[model samples]
Target: MKKKITLSILISEILNLISAPLAHAASLSDVYLPGKALGGSGATIGGFVTPLIQNLALLMTGLTFIILLLSGFKYITSHGNPKGTQQAKDMLTYSLVGLVLSIAAYWITKLAFVAAGLDFLF
Candidate 1:
């Protein structure tokens, strides 16, 4: 019972610290400035960068998916032709590379921001 009470007190304090920011946000702006959400507060630059990155990410991902789907269709339609099959495989492989690179870039950027002490995006 004593241990439980102590744990509860600690947890409550943590919750208060975390939520104290909520009591002060002027807007739900982090949705826009994910990468710029530093200073422990939201800013206009962050708000803009967040949505821009999100939209570009979505666009790139969608394009990659579309490429993969089209490549699958080509491979399927190639039937038994070795040449057509090879081309389709290359397309799929290139698309995979693009996807991997995009994801890596995102992580690298996050690490860079962290190393710069720019505050981790929320």
Candidate 2:
């Protein structure tokens, strides 16, 4: 059924988001932000900001998913009502836009660092 397909897709997306952080966790910890040299530890910007960016992406993804869920719920509860359906659709659209913007921001930040010639694995 359509509902089943939607539910499965949502689950797949949730799984993807959950696994994302784990995938890049190693790189995050290895970041060495540049700062005042401490003893023998080389002064590195606060090191790398990949963790922050990753965490932010995760947060935004979660929020977008929540929005999508809420919109779906609204659509279901509307029971053929036109205005409510429209509202739900609008929410879905906005959430998708937000997700895209978050992704863009993440990449832009990374691009900025790259443009500056800073060497850090993203």
Q: Give the alpha-carbon lDDT of every model.
A: 0.78, 0.81
lDDT of 1 by residue, 1-122 (tens): 99999999999999999978865663556555542445454355545565666676678899999999999999999997999999999999999999888878767766776676665445
Model 1 Cα shift for residue 96 (angstroms): 0.5
Model 2 lDDT tens row, 1-122 = 99999999999999999988755554433445322222235434525476767888999999999999999999999999999999999999999999999999988888888898875465
Number of clashes found in candidate 2: 9
* TM-score of each predicted structure versus truth: 0.59, 0.63
- Give lDDT for model 1: 0.78
Top lDDT prediction, candidate number = 2
Q: Candidate 2 regions off by >4 Å?
A: 1-43, 46-48
lDDT of 1 at 24: 61
- For model 1, the stretches where C-alpha displacement exceeds 4 angstroms are 1-44
Local error of candidate 2 at 58, Å? 0.8
